[model samples]
Target: MRAGWWSLVATLLTLPLAARGASAQTSGYLDVDGAWVAPWEGAPNHGRALSIAPAIRRDWQRYSLSSEGAATLADPSHYYVQNLVTATRRSREWRRINFESGLLAGGLAYRGEGFRTIGAEKVPIARELFQLQARGRADVALDKWGFSLTATGGENFGGAVRQPWGVEAGMTRELGRVLLYATARADRFREYDTVLVHDVATLDSYALSATGGRAEEYRTVQPLLTMTGGGTVAMGRAELTTEFGVQQGRRMIDPARPRARKAWTELIASLAATYRIAPRILLRIGGGLYPTDYVRQLPQGKFVSVGLRLERGRRQQVDWYLPPDLPAFRIDTLPGGARAVRLRAPRALKVDISADFTDWTPVPMRRLKGGDWEAVLPIAPGTYRVSVRVDGSEWSAPPGLVGVLDEFNGEVGLVVIR
Candidate 1:
């Protein structure tokens, strides 16, 4: 329903900011995407759209909450909105195994003025659906594997009433800077009157609104089966992600009729790239082919998309220190009222430092020769807690700097900036 969708999305977008004062770890992001789409087979349904997705995650003592929302508006008045909020209760680890259970609430809606035309082609578009599910998850650190099960029920996926029941299991492993994952899933689906799958490449939010029919529903005994594999590689300022999947499912051969069943198979592949423009700014681009949407009763299509995202994870973070005209193991006053801090450990491979000012997030130092590190930074002419780790080892204070106990009962080095 367009009723409270925008208000809900506004709440989700501002939730992280509202939780900043809490003792929880809170982060959020906002994405703005511009999309263009064309029907995979038909003459043409080419159109332009704008989409926005706001997401937030909060982690507290023994629980966590994740909320995501989206809204899209297309040319000639096509609109869609979606929301998913999940709250999980974390369990105490038992012998290398961790467990979690949560409830999920997801909903979406879309509508356009009955018929929109491009050239001489007119297409109908109206979609909306809602669902709720309970999920249980288990993760084992021994092999870096995670399994999850969900019992779900929803309304208006394809028919008058949504077919319930869906389950998915996945595992992930990290190798160096690359992460690999695989998943298998099965879900029941059905459709009723209108085919709401609409256009895939139009706006991602459109797909999220998959709902069918006003009268009867299409249903079969078999569930949709899918298998997927994906990987992500992180490079300095850039990252690449890829996914490949195969889906086998049954649905109404013709979306209009509440008829028997038809089996279909499809291949899914996509690539996405992201570049960090700044601590809180990012640029992203992605596209690929899609499979049939049973909920909206729409056929499969291809897509390409580009977007910009603003992340809260690294907000207000400090930059890596830079080399300056300062001596190692000493401090010097630099131009522009800045102070230079230097290290002279020539045998160390790499050096990093953190201070109270940097929120204790380590900032790398410019290395010369073997391990001589130096960086220029600005700080008030006062004393502050500092710590250094060489080659990313345990934090410790070097000679000539005061050593004291920190809030965590750990040792920290003291640096005086003049």
Candidate 2:
């Protein structure tokens, strides 16, 4: 099966030059690559396999589309295709609204002999089997903060056919080099036992329902931090990056089991370095490890993966789009002698304002004429460091300071909300 899949891919790549001429006018690029996985401690022992994939992308002034198809060679053939489309409109400043959707399809094939023996009796064998799956996602975004929902369903007809479906919602935010995200998901599956049991009149069928099995549903929240720095050093071209991530979740299992509920957590840390080998290529090396723990079960094992990526592109650009109408800041004195400061920015920006020693959360600031922004917060009548951010980008104050830390290039200002 693997050989057959590779043959087909070779044929496609060897097509006449004239056959490829039709894509000359397309704006997107094409990527083709393959990977080989070695047997691991707990993974299946498939010697090796090859895969081929082709992708295309096109972007217009306000719309973009991308599609790709992949075929993998193994004992059982695996194939899939993914397509996505998005439309976006930029309002004023850097505020923009976007709508996106995508689809995915795939299947598995199994071809093997099945034989059985029962108390000095031998039984003959029969046919093959496989599984199919389909999934989709839709989302809307306002600048850095966006909302996404997804659904997936799959069925296995070969062995004790069963079906499963699930849905999920997620939110993402960026703060300078730090990213915060959280997701809640619920899914249900039909359970079937393939092994035969003696004197068992009937087999039990378990159906996970959306409302009944809250324990079966799982939710995860993850927050990550990444730092990047690079410049010429004494020995040679030098670059460094560090990242840290943590995740926690709760999971459900068979109700018949005494301990059917479980919780899990994971942590990851990584560091990388790069040295210039040439103008077009660089020598890169990196390593990272992830550790996870689960309740009632033997703690899950950890693994580390290290690889390099060669990149070729023009110099990067920092583009900041600020709407023509910026939010206004208002100050008011309360009867109790407390001061109030308010700022109103675009709803999409998810603007958050805070001073030293105060936690920032979402607040409704009234909209004013001319796209003006306003916010009110009582301060102790002293100078304080004020900070504002939309999505992950910090608003730049006068003097071109990006943010609180110059190293982070975030936005910060010294304002007395009093």
Candidate 3:
């Protein structure tokens, strides 16, 4: 099943240059995290869990493809792994609203021990299952006020996987360097029809209602509300980020497993901070406290993580532009047979230029008093291709130049060096 998917990803990564006459970029990262979940609500299996995740992503002109895999190690001697791949298409903003949609496919596997009904007695049985899943999401953003909405749904095939559907809406406000944001989400899951219910009271009630019914399928719903606000401040060689959030939700536990209640109310307050120790490495510490469901044994909802991120090329900047300050490009010829390149971006940190003439290495342009940028390069009269990086953002062809695909599978603007 995965062989075909990997092949599809390869084809998609290459087709942007072949079909669209443009270029693209491929990037990825690897991360490892460890945490200890103290015993909560007298749960049997509670201990340290280590997780490793790796991902690869490719970006084209208006679409992108990404693949990620994750594995978890638990103290109870169980194995769980998952792989997900997604493709997305982005649409240009109409007025102040932007839209995007994504399609995803994935697989999950779990190995554990469980009780199986045999004759009249339950016996321990090895539980190993694999599941395939496909999902889709649609997101909408109102650029004027930083409001967004998203909806997603997915189905699982094989084993005891649950079909999930969810929706989220959020908003963000930026005042100076401080950012405030909040989100509200609701998710619903439908379990497989073959799973047996282990909740004695719920099972008895179901049997009484159906006159001879055996529990087959179960449904769980969760509605959560969360709000967080934080900002990143540059402190000398490192950057410091702090955030606090409050979450309240109702989680319907798996009916196939015996639990305290059919649905439990969850309320937690969380605080997290991160310090960038270096350009590519960071240190993170976070913890949560249960206000309503706090138990003496699970005092620490704590975690610490160290992350290292590497990239091959320049980083993309936030695509934020006020209505009147969009970036544009222009070119002019000088008396000394030099080509003068100009870019108009009233609100930009820096603008850099790169072309085949420059060996594809970026060189900064001088910012003019008029809030634009200009760079004069000596070149013979000929046609050349050039790409610009605005404020260390993604490589893009400036407006007014002919768009052509680059060797990296992305688009660049064609310029006349004459």
> What TM-score does each of the candidates earn?
0.66, 0.37, 0.59
Give the Cα lDDT of each candidate: 0.64, 0.39, 0.54
Give the C-alpha lDDT of model 1: 0.64
The residue pairs that clash in candidate 3, if any, are 21-405, 22-405, 22-410, 23-409, 23-410, 23-411, 24-409, 24-410, 381-418
For residues 1-418, write the lDDT of model 2, one tens digit per residue: 3422343343334333212322121222232333333222335433343444444433323343333334444345322222222222222323342334333322222232222222222322222223345655666666656576767666645432356566777766544333345565555554332222221333232332223322232222222222222221122134555555554544433223323445555555555555545432345555454432111011222333333333222111121222333324445687887665545332222344555626445444444553334565555766555555443323333222222442344445665543
Better-scoring candidate (TM-score), 1 or 3: 1
RMSD in Å for model 1: 10.8
Error of 3 at 85 (Å): 0.9
How accurate locally is residue 332 in candidate 1, as Cα lDDT from 0 to 100?
Answer: 72
Strongest candidate by lDDT:
1
Better of 1 and 2 by lDDT: 1
Q: Write the per-residue lDDT of candidate 3 for residues 164-260, one digit (tens) a residue.
A: 6667777776543345566776665543324333455655222112233454654433344544555554332233456555555543333444232
Clashes of each: 5, 22, 9
At residue 27, what lDDT does model 3 achieve? 54
Q: Could you give me the TM-score of model 3 versus the true structure?
A: 0.59
Stretches of candidate 2 exceeding 4 Å from the true structure: 1-97, 107-144, 154-162, 198-302, 308-418
Worst 10 residues of 3 by lDDT: 291-300
RMSD of each: 10.8, 17.8, 8.6
